[model samples]
Target: MWHAVKTLNAHNGYVCALIAKVARYSVSAALRKESVALVYKSHGDPMQVLKLQKLNLPALGDSEVLIKMLAAPINPADINMVQGTYAVLPELPAVGGNEGVGQVLEVGGHVTSFRPGDWVIPRDAGLGTWRKELVLKEHALLRVPSDIPLACAATLSVNPCTAIRMLSDFENLQPGNSVIQNAANSGVGQAVIQIAATKGIKTINVVRNRPNFQTLTEYLQSLGADYVITEESLRKPEMKDIFKNIPHPRLALNCVGGKSATEMLRHLQHGGTMVTYGGMAKQPVTAPVSSLIFKNVKLCGFWMTQWKRDHEHEMGELNEMISSLCSLIRQGKLKAPAYTEVPITDYKTALENAMKPFSSSKQILVM
Candidate 1:
């Protein structure tokens, strides 16, 4: 009986140890999340520097949320960031995306801003969006309406927001007013055309001469561009014919600086504003003396990142702009630019295609 009692005690102790070990493992597995991200340790050619690596996320904090990324587009700015040429460069050994949409898979106990299944987007640039999953503070994300298309939500924060602000803040444009913009086939340019159209405004889109110019023109026209002209067209005497139908543009949007901007500025209505948002040509904007002195063309620059930072605490206007854009998207008045969705595993292909010239399609990484 003594031997049997001793054996029973040993068995009980072993059972307790087994249960404790399983409990510890269960807690660990519950607390940790695994993710894969496109990480770059140094600035160089993106293809050479970017790597896919598994990431183990720390346990969620009280103000944190666990997100599963849905889609992220490879914008020119993103490419520039990876190349260390963009105005905003994240710290090295960082994930590679700046814009994307994700869905909440879980939220911390004290997190009030989001719950499971809520859709969210980075509140600003440089949140490292090229990943399968992540843990971010609630303040780092902004909730987006989930009913909209995934692709639209994935791309909402930067280009469209820039377009909306430039159109609304730069000029008090009324119906029948015309807006001229270069890089009209770009994502922001497309947004400008469509948003201007909804307000009964007209867009004179200028694109570089391409072999498929006619098709591109028709496509921009279909998106409500009233005029699609090549760089060469902006200089010819025939350009006067465009003004015969529509008044001279009072607001000029310049993404491509240098001669392209000078050409766009030449046609602006007297006292009109030319807001420079990008320097695609890598050249200084040269304003003709006559245009500056006589035309009173106001030349200014806009960086969306700065704008967001300025409005970080005062988000009422920002939220309104986002809501307004989403409403337009639901109504079909606005649409995402032409995009080719590539899986996250195929990021190399997406990155390669995005760097191609005259590639109209935006490369989107779908998780």
Candidate 2:
């Protein structure tokens, strides 16, 4: 009886090894013949260092999902990252995108929240969605609602989330309260304006004058911006007239540093708080001592990653905010911002365009 049991165990081991070989062959057969991805070979010059090349699709890991890229935005952070100026840097020869929307092609056995054909977007940085395909851990992707526009969904990760956190994290804001922000023509700025509008909160928006300040102000106002002023206007003698009727804002959001940041603070009320999220001007933000000492004003910084880490247990709150914003889009209460969609074949041109001064719209790359 002992001899017979030993022979049976050996036969089962042989059967398991054969099954593994067949499974490997099946996976190899299922992979795409060729998929293209943009690889960063160096840091200093992004255009020269990054190149698109054909490579085999990576095998999915136990907690991973393979997504077929649908759309991605060439955001300012993405440009800075490729140029090695951004705070976070990935390993050399890494892929080069931070946000994108895609459809799940397959999910590993351990992934439970998503299945094949579900629309999803990156929830974290460095998954590098600027490719024909991607394999990311399930935790790094967020499921997007089907009703959202593909273009809008593609751009959701950073800008919208930033706006939501900035608004919600501050002390409870009422309808009559106001918020001031510079770079108000930006995606985040626009999102803040719309979100504030939904909450019946007024916005004091500031923008640098391009050749077309008239058109820009009108556009911002149409999106429910209560007041839109150019940077030059902030320095003008009659600046007080603009704020004569508006209350001193309790919250300020500054993206451009240097003088622009100082000007944003000037609009805040006594004891108001300023949150600096970006320094597009590449200069340190300076606040006059009088404002801090006499006014008791507070200065704070906002990094979305930090907020995400601290509020890990509040994902439900974040999702609720996002869903409400999406509802606004569905009702046609929100307008999709202007953007140029570049196809994969024209990625070189897209990269060049993304590096230029901010457009009135965003630049999207469609895979």
Candidate 3:
């Protein structure tokens, strides 16, 4: 089979041109079915082409499995990658989505852990998940609990993993220790707040002022946010006095870079660490050298890919942590991220909605 695939690639147009020579032979009808996929051809282009074309079900490798994508989300990272701004770039004409929940349809002969009908989620990023179906190496997928909602499971891979890493990587936060973060209304930010609450930690969330700021704050507070403040409020003269009452957070998570990062750093205690996970502001993180030298502050960055590669030994631990979070959902201790479901048939509209500014809800592509 591998030799046949290689031959097909090698012959290319020649084989098709010479099809008359083999027209008598019958081909399998299964090869004629079409599937819709989001294909990217160029970077920095506003147009995204979706193609519905015939594709044979990929033959399984010794360690591969075939899956039907159940749901996927349009994360900021997905958009960044599509726009060619992300650090990693896949070959052109590639499909765009990093996270998805799927159900296994077939498994290779040697596969031991999964079978048909089992639900799974991609364990890594850039697996071309924005399609009706996929064929991936067995190890690239993680089995999701059956009880987890398909929509929530679709977003589990990126935001939830990020939240877990942010809370675990910094100082071992105790029950009373507080942490500050910008973009507190974001998916990862919300996950962080809930996870921290589960661990008995406090969070000071900062978000841009919106018409529903009061309602938003109340919503976050319901998720166990110790305090929620607007970014504008952080610049007030009374901010310094407010700090005296709230413990100086020893760790900070900054998703919004630029001046917002600098402001977040100000709320950290001396000798504290601030990890920049994203640059949502499209600007560089600028912090005074005096803070690093005199205050002994530490600035770091986190890329989930690098972290996962370095900590392969902790896969079991990571799975356990996610399972615990799922348990919280079952007990109503953790609230799922607010989201709007977009049917896959109207993918263009979904993408447009995802690109809209200041949306309170995440956009999910429901299959």
Candidate 4:
């Protein structure tokens, strides 16, 4: 009898092994024949370092999901990262994008959290998004609503989240209160205007003077900017009259540093808060001592990556924020920046376009 029982157990183990092998082969068969990536062995000029590689999709591991890239933005941070100047650098031979939207193609047998056909974004930055496909652990992804605009979902995580956090986290702002920001035509700036507009908060926007300055101003105003002015226009004495019509700005979001940031600081009301998120100007932020001492203006900095790192414990709250942002998009309250899409094969053109001077729209890589 003991021999019979041992034989039965061995037979069951053999059957289980056969099932596992068959499942593995099924998954392998399910994946596409080819995959591609934009990879760099070392940081330097992105246009110089990034190259396309064609390869077969590796076997998916337990708790892993294979994703096909949908769209990824060419953000300023992406540019800086390739230059090896950003605060965080991936290990050598890394993928080049930090954020993007992707769809699950296949999942490992052990991955229960996601399935084929779900839309997701990297849970944090540095996921190497500029590619045709990637294999990532299911936990590294955050599911987003698949029904909304593809562009909105693709670009949702960074610029919009920064705008939302700066709007809510910094000051005790109420409806009817005013917010001011430079680089108002930027993705984050446009998000700030639309979000603040949704909340009935007024926005005083600043942008650089360009050949199409008036057209851009009109565009932003349509996005709910209470007022829009050029950086040079802001520094002019005429701003005194401009201030007469609107309440002094209570909060300032600074992306352009140098003289532009200094001017944004100067326009802040007494006890206002200035949050610096970027320095596209590539210059140091300057402020007069009197403004810091007498007016009691507060200067703070925000890095979206660091914010995510610090608040890793608040995932539920993060989900709530993400849901709210998605809802805003579904309702058309929040609009994604204008995007020019490039096929993965045309990445060279996309990078060059993003590097253009005063380029009118954002560039996104689409699979």
Best by TM-score: 1
lDDT scores of the candidates, listed in order:
0.85, 0.76, 0.75, 0.82
Per-residue lDDT over 239-289 for candidate 3, one digit per residue giving the tens place of the 0 to 100 score? 676576678888999999998889888878999999999888978888899
lDDT of 1 by residue, 142-243 (tens): 899999999999989999999999998888999999999999999999999999999999899999999999999999999899999998989998789989
Over 1-367, each residue of candidate 4 has an lDDT whose tens digit, in order, gives: 0000001122124321110001011233455456677878787888899998764555677887889889999998888777777655555566678789999999989988787899998877776788788777776788898999888998999999999999999898889888989999999999999999999898988988899988998999888998898888887887887678777788999998999889888889999999999888878789899999999999999988767767777888778888999999999999889889899789999999998888878899998
Shift in Å, residue 207, candidate 4: 0.9
Clashing pairs in 3: none
Judged by whole-model lDDT over C-alpha atoms, candidate 4 comes out at 0.82
lDDT of 1 at 263: 91
Per-candidate TM equals 0.91, 0.88, 0.88, 0.89
Which candidate gets the maximum lDDT versus the true structure?
1
Higher-ranked by TM-score: 3 or 4: 4
Residue 272 miss distance in model 4 (angstroms): 1.0
Which segments of model 3 are wrong by more than 4 Å?
Answer: 1-34, 45-54
Error of 4 at 241 (Å): 2.7
Over 4 Å off, model 4: 1-34
Residue by residue across 195-280, what tens digits does model 2's lDDT show?
89989988989998787888989999999999888887777766677567667889999999999989877778899989999989
In model 4, what lDDT does residue 169 have? 93
